[model samples]
Target: MIGSGPGGALTAWSLAKDGHSVTLIEAGPRLRRPDFGQSIGHMLASYFWDGGARTSRGNVVFPTMQVRALGGGTVFNSAICMRPLESALERWRDEHGLTEMTSEMLDPHFDAVETFLNIKAADDDILGRRNELFREACSELGWEWEHIKRFEEGCVGSGECITGCRAGAKNSLDKRGVAEVVQAGGRVYTSVHIDQLIVEHGRVRGAVGMTVDPETYERRHPVRIHAGCTIVSAGAIGTPTILRRSGLTRPAVGSALRFHPSCYIIGVFDEEVNPWFGATQGIHATEHLEKGIKLEALWATASTFSRTLPKRPKQFKRYLKRWPNMAVWDGWVSGDASVGDVRVLPGGRPDIRWQMGDADLRRLQETNALLCEMYAAVGAKEVFTGIVGLPDVMDPREAADRLREGRFERTEMPTASNHVFGGSPMGTDEERAVCDGWGQVYGIDDLYICDTGLYPSSPGVNPQLTAMALAHRLGQELPERY
Candidate 1:
């Protein structure tokens, strides 16, 4: 297993439970509770890829927030657990020929993950003031909203879910699944890079890479491990880079990249919302999802909020002054029309090239309209659209008019995405996909990809639960062959 995110960790846990010997190799260092603190700077340095600085470009430039820790994204994500919507599964079946990835077939896997992770809906007791405002706005706007479920145990609403929770609340893979794997006799190698798979006689025998200390940047020694079967869960970016570097050059191996491109909306009310008090995010709406759009509250922290603020010192300081009154919401549209490719740079790093297609752009505008309306509906006295051409709206009626007339340009808004799906897709069609219905890579014996990269299209929602479910289904089924 070449990763430790939900897909990789869950697969490892399952395989180990089946009495299989597993060696989980992670390129990043392991940080436990002792190494963690409240500093966002330390969190980024210790957990995130490029210290949370990597960005992608094409039609629009945006930060791609991938993690580089023992547990990968499970370490820094908000722990939002959502099963794949049935509508998205239908698209995967009809368009991508993923016939068996139906909701009914994967129900057991989802149930297993939810039970293991202790997933539960956020209750009113923990929903914080920010959520109260958001829920009220959704109600007033006549949009159906729901409390988001999270993988948590003793959660105290620390509001630091994004930067690695030290409260021992969020059930990140490192604390849950990965720990179980270790308990089941699986070995883990952290801070060791896997350069490429060793293919011999059309079969994966092992992999080779060097051990480098993440703290000192010192190359220690080259290492190799031989395994009976190989699975790549290095995520959408890392997996493709590894395959291409190892000479797997099928077109689908690095194509069909998709994302739920997103922006934020901040509204200021007379009373202090103290937006940083409770759970990072516990509320969201799927009312407009058929249009490939969704809205949720952001996991706002001081460091993240400052980063999303205006570039200008004066304009930025102004927002800081009003920070107490500010309540932020997030919006995203599944980039259905926006297909992209991940290319291996000369140094083995992945370069993602993507631009929002017309559909995605329109979706963004529609999201802006909905978000602006929500803020207006909530009796916000001042609303900041986070848009360049648009000014602060003081009147709800004017906000609606401007939203309708607004011509959204890519340059005007800041965007960030944690959900990057697809690079090597899996399906029954051998020619267009790199992996089969079983997630086995074509022409590569004993090697498979078990991650969201296997997704032929974006699921348009939080994908961790879906990825875990699919990985569990395949992991349990594939061991019989081994």
Candidate 2:
């Protein structure tokens, strides 16, 4: 295993359960459940890359927030355990030549993940005030919303998922998949960052990297590992960076980077909604998921909330005063944008650059407007958006007008994408895709990428199940090692 995120962890578990010798290597340190604390910012500061992380585009740095802990990104996610949207799967087939990613092909794998991860629909009894309001608003507006399935138990509805779950109830790989992998006789190396792949003549032989202490940030010792077959599960960002550095010259190595670009809407309730009270279960408007829009409710801790405020401190302070009553609605665009690239910097570091086109911008505006309507229809006092210098939309028409004007500078536009994918896509065409349908990298013998990087296109939903399903499928394809 080349990385210990969800895909790597699951793949390691699968292989180890198959009675194979497996070593799971993770770039970051193992985040303990006790380390999950009150200060969300402090936790994020330690577990996130580059100080909660950022991406760059021609000197413009866009924050790319991904978890650098043992569980990986799931540690900081909203715990929305959605299966691959059927429409999204179709789009992948038509647009990206992913013919084999059909529902039938993915059913058994999904079942396995659901069983192992303990996925269950959030019971209505535990829905927080905001989630209830959201449901009420959806009912009032006739907007379709689904009760999201989540991998959580004993959720006290404290909604600190974006921070870290203190109750240790979240379904992050650390708690579930990786835990099973370890018990199933898998060796997991924490704080071991694999910098480069040992590739020779189009075959992955081994990897060389160092283990660093998360607190001291000191290199522990130089280490090298030999594997019969190496799998890259360093996520879309880290995986592509390694493949490029290893001399895989496929054009799509760093192309078609699809992201579900998200914008958040804030509403102040008459009574305390306490947005940070539930499991942060993502109840999305599935009706619009394939149409390039999704509306879901979420919240943040104090620091992340501060980032959402207007640059003016006075306005921010004014909003902070009403923090108790504030609830957030997030709009994610399944934007018609392909990924750019994660270029290797001179210092052996990685830098990612992406640009959204007119269609994406339009879709963003449309989705935000829709969310505002949903909130406003249910008697929200006002709706504040992430767009800077734009007036808070009290009326639906004003919101539509703001979206119609398409002169947004990339700097003004937020460019953070939690869902990163397609650095090494699977396809039949070697020139267009990196891996084959079996996830074996083309032109490379016994080298496979069974992570989200193998996604030919963004599924516009949570990619966790999809990645796991792919890994399970790959495990079935592997021959017995004897």
Candidate 3:
């Protein structure tokens, strides 16, 4: 296993439990529970890729946060556990030849993951005022909504999930799957960066990289590991770059990149929402899912939230005072029309280029419009749309009207995405997909990819659960096949 995220950790644990010797390697350090609770800046520098400054390159530049810690993104994400939509699975089957990836085939694996991780809906106590307001808005609009299922056991609702769960309530894979793998006698290594694979005679024999200091990030020594079967779970960007560096020059190696581009709207209510004290993301609505949108309540630290405020000192200070009364709501668009690719740069870093299609941009506008309407229904005094050329603060109805008209260009809309997919996508056509439906690399023996990169397109929801489902399925078959 060439990563320790959900896919890598779960697969490693599964194989180890079945009496297979497994070796898991992670590029980032293994963080203990005590290492959390730091400021957002500190956490970003220590845990995020490129110190949380990594962004996609193309017409519009926006931050694309990718975690670089043991347990991967699961360590930092809100632990939203959403199954891939049946419509998305059907599209994959019809368009990408991923017939075996249906919910019927993967639900058992999902159940196992949920059971092991204690996945459940956030209780009312943790839903904070912000989440409750979202629920109220959804109810008023007659839109379907539900409490988000999360991998939390004893959550305290500190609203610090993105910075890492300080309470240790989040059931990140590091504490579950990776820990179980160790109990099963699997070898684990952290702060080890693998750049290339040892491919010989069309089979991956092992991998080679350098060990780095966990804190300083200074290179320490070169290391190599030989394995009978190698699984690359280095995530959407890392997996494809490693393949390309190892001379696997197939065109499909780094193609078909996708994302859930999202943005948030701040609704300033007369009553104190206390946005910073709640489940990081507790409630969500999928009523607009067919239109490629999903809505959820959002929360972040005061300093992190301040960054999105007005730059002028007086105006910023004024808004800062209103923070206690603000509720932030977020919506993401399933970026099916948008596409991108990952390429290994001349310098050793991965170069990601993505272009958001016009249709997806319109979807973003529509999402903002819907959020404005939701705020209006909930009796918010004003809203912050964050759409360029529009007033920073406006009446909810006015914002909705302007946003729904789609008067802005792509560049005018600010967007970011943490949910990225594709690059090493799976399909029956060897020439088009780097891996088969079973995650086995098409032309390579004893090598597989079990990550979001295997998704031929966007899953249209939180993707971590689906990624784990795929890994679980691959784990069950690998021990039998190899």
Candidate 4:
């Protein structure tokens, strides 16, 4: 195991439980309560990569956020556990030649993961004021929405989903996969960085990397180790970087990066609607998927809310005055047209180049405009859309016109994605993809990649469930000869 995230930890646990020796290496240490402070800067230093890592193309830098600590992004993510929609699975099978993705093949794995992780519906009591307002607004507009499925077991609703859970109720593989692997005699090494894969005669031999000294902050230079098989679970970005550094070049090394670009709608109400008292990603509108949009409620801290307020001093004052009456909602684009690339940089850092296209940009604008209208329908005194060149509360006619006529280019769009896909992608043809249906690298023996990178395309939903399902299926099919 070359990473300690959900994919890596789960892979190690599965292999070790099957009576295999495994050594899990993590570049960062296990995140503790002190490391997950209220300060974003402190949290970034401890869990994130240099205030959030970025990939550059020419002069424009595209920012991507990933958790570098143990448990990976799940440590700081809102615990929204949704399986990939059936429509997406059918599309993969009918259109993408992924015939094995049928429900018959997937349901058993889903059941296993859900049972192991304890997936359930979010409690309505913990649904914050924003959720109440959102439901009311959706009802008024005759829109269909659903409460989110969460992976938390007895969540106390501290509303600190972005920060590492102090309650330890969030089941993001740390308490499940990591615990199982460790208990089964597998070793997990923290603060270890892998530099390259050791490939010998078209087979994965092992890997070499360094272990870091926490107190001195110095690396001991990664030591080499041999294994019969090597699985690349370092995530979409990390896995591709490792492969590229090791001189493994396939046509689809780092291509087809898709991100569900999202924007927030801030609604100012008359009554206190503290959104920070519930699941961060609970309550979403999936009805708009056919229309290329999805709406969801979000919880944010005061600092994050303050940062998103208008820059003008007067606007800032107004925002603070109505802080207690504010609620945040999310709008996500559904089209799979945008493209981003992940490449290895000069200093061995992973570089990403992401930008949206005209159609996708237009859809995002439309979605944000619709959210603003929905907020107004729900008796919001004022609606704030984070889109440029649009009024805070434009009328329906004005909103439509502004959204359609907006000249904002793809590069000008505000974008950031925690959900990443492609790179070592899976497809029928080896020439078009790095991995096959079994997640085996086309040309290498004893080398498998069981992670989000195997996603053929963005499923327009949380990738964790699909990732785990695929990993389970792959593990079940591991070659006996190995």
Candidate 5:
């Protein structure tokens, strides 16, 4: 395993339990409870790639977040466990030639994963004002909404899922799957960076790289590992870059990248929300999912929140004063229309290029409009649209109208995507996809990809659950095949 996020950790655990000798290598440290920071700035520097400042280049400079840790994004995400939508699986089957990628084939694995991770819906008791307000708005609008299902066992509702769960309630892979892998006699190496694969006679032998100090990031001892079979679960960006650096120059190696292209709006109300005290993201609406939109309640620390504020110091300060009475609601477009690619730069850095298609941008505009309506339904006094051309603050109806009717370009919107997919997609056509139906690299022997990078198209929902399901299925087959 070349990475130890959800895919990596879960796969490694499965292999280890099956009595396979597993070696899990992680680029980031095995952060303990104390190491998980409270503030967003501290957590980003510690857990995220590029201190959470990494962005794609092209038509729009959109931000992307990737985690670098033993448990990967499972440690930092809100633990939203959404099954792959049947419609998306159908698309994969019809358009991508992934005939077996259906709910019937994958639901058992999803069930096992949910059972192991203790995934369940968040209780109403912990759905603080922010989440409650979202639920109320959804009810008022008669849109279908539900409590977010999560891997929280003893959650205290600190609303710190993005930073890290300090209460030890979150079932992050580092605390669960990775730990089980170790107990089952798997070897785990932390802070090890794999530059490229060791290809011998057109087959992967293993990988080569160096270990670095977790905090200083100073290069340390040279490291190399030889394995009978190598699985790269290094996330959507990391996996493709490693494949490219290894001289796997097939066109499909880093092609067809995709994202959820998400943004959030703030609703300032008259009552105190204390947004930072509840489950990080506890309620979500899927009414517009057919249109590629998913809405949810969002919260972050004050410092992170301040970054989304207006540039005008006066207006910024004014918003800061209303923090206690504000709630953040966010939405994401499936990004089926958008496309991107990852290329390895001279020094092994990833150069990501992407462009948001006009169709997806319009979907985002509709998403913003829906969010405005939701806030308005709940009687928000004012809203911050965060679109460049729109006023920083406006009445809910005016914001909704501007969002619905405005002639907006992709560049005018501030969007980011925590959920990214593609690059080393799995498909029947070797000419288009880097991996095959079983996640085996098309032309490479004993090498596989088990990550979001293997997704041929958007899964149309939060992807962690589906990513794990794929990895779990791959794990079951690899031991038998190899």
Candidate 6:
């Protein structure tokens, strides 16, 4: 097993439970609780892939965050738990020959994962002003808003979910799945990088790479192992790079990337909102997602908050003064048909390229306007948007009108995605899929993938739960197949 994220961790734990000797190789260091802090930069530098500064190499330049630590994204995410939408997964079943996946079929697996992670909805007492504002706005708009489930049992509402949980309330893979795997006699190797799959006699035997030094990140000891089977459970970014480096010519091995490109808007209130005292995203609007537009209450540090601020120093500082009262709403929509790709660059690193279609950009604009209306309804003093030419939208109606017909050159809009999937999609179709229904790489026996990269398309929601569910499906079925 390669990678120790959600999909990787769950798959490893299940395999170990079935008496399969598994060696989980993670490309990052094993960080203990004391290593984490409120410093986002410190978290990124220590636990993230490429120090969290990686960007796509094209016109649609944006930060592509990927955690390379012991638990992968489970270590850094907001712990939001969401099942795959039946409406979206059904499309994959019909088009991608994914008969193994269905919401009904995965109900037990979802329940099991929820139990293992101790998933629970945040109670009203733990909610902050931002959550209250979102709930009130959703009620006024008659849009559905609910307490999102989190893998936290006794959360203290630290508002540092993205940075790394210091309170130890979060059930990240290291504390749950990986810990169980270790207790079950499974071996997990941190700071070990697996570069290529070792194909022997037309079958994957194992993998080879080098152990990286935790301090300098320099390749240390060479590594080679032989196993009965190899599952590439690396993340969406890491999995595709492995396939390309192994000389897989299938176009789908490193193409057809999908993401939920996100934008943000801030609401300035009369009272100090201090939006950094609760979960990163405790309340959300998903009921009226006819166009795949989702809204969630969000707050971040000055660096993260600066992403949507005006570029000019003077203008940016002006908003910084009112940061105490600023509460942000993160809006996201599905990426359009203008697909993206992740190719292996020199030295076997992944390079991303993406461009959003005009329709998708327009949908994001519409969502932005809708958030403005919500903030206005809640009596916000000011609405600050990240639109290129426009900064602050003081009037809700004017914001709606201008966003509907604004000259938003998509290149200028800063966009990022938490849910990146579909580089190595699952299907029987040769042209569009890199693997079969059970995550068996086409034409490569004994090699499989159990990660978000197997997603045929973006689920348009939180993908951590979806990734684990799919990995669980693979773990249950692969034993039978082989």
Report lDDT per candidate: 0.82, 0.75, 0.90, 0.74, 0.90, 0.82
How would you encode candidate 4's per-residue C-alpha lDDT over 1-482 as one tens digit per residue? Answer: 78877678777776777777788888777766555566765676556765565444532234567877777778888877778877777777776677888888889888877777788877788777777778777888888988888778878777787877777788877667887888889988878888889998988898888887643436886588788888888888888889888888665877666667777767778888876777776788877876667788887677776666677889788777777788888787754777766788898878777666677777877777677777777777776665555664444445545665677755555655677777777777667678877778877888888778887776667777788777766656664646
TM-score list, all predictions: 0.96, 0.94, 0.99, 0.93, 0.98, 0.96
Could you tell me the TM-score of candidate 2? 0.94
Report clash pairs, candidate 2. 157-277, 256-339, 257-339
Write one digit per residue (lDDT tens) for candidate 3, span 1-482: 99988789888877887778999999999999889975888888988889989998987886898899999999999999989889999989999888887888889999988888999999999989999999999999999999999999999999989888989999999988999889889999999999899999999999999998998777889999999899999999999999999999878889998889998888889999999989999999979987789999987566876666766899989999999999889999999889999998996789999999988998999999999999999999999877789987899999999888757888899899999899989999888899889889988898999999999987878999998888877788897897
Mind giving the per-residue lDDT tens digits that candidate 2 earns over 1-482? 78777778878777777777788888778877788887876876788877675665743345667778777787777777777778778877887677888999889988887888888887776678778877777888887888888878777777788778888888888888888878888888888878788988777898888889877667788989888888888888788888887777567786666667777777766788777676576466676877877778776455666566555878878878777787777777775663566767876677687767667776777777777777776777766676755764345445545655646655565546687777777787777888777777888786888778777776778777788877776666675532
Across 353-378, the per-residue lDDT of candidate 5 in tens digits comes to 99889999999999999999999999
TM-score of 4: 0.93
lDDT of 1 by residue, 55-130 (tens): 8778788778888878889888889988877888898899878888777889999998899889999877777888
Model 6, 1-482: lDDT tens digits are 99999889999987787777778999888877888888888888877778888777655776778988889898888898888777777778898878867878888889888888899888787778888888899998889888989998788887888887888889999889999889889999999999998887789899999999886689999999788889998888889898788877577887788788888888888888888877778898887565688888885566677666566889778878878787888888867455788998798889888778887777778888888888878888777786777754466556767787776877756677777888888887978898887788888789988888888886767788987877776777777866
Model 4: residues with Cα > 4 Å off, grouped in runs = 53-61, 213-218, 392-401, 404-407, 479-481
lDDT (C-alpha) at residue 388 in model 5: 89
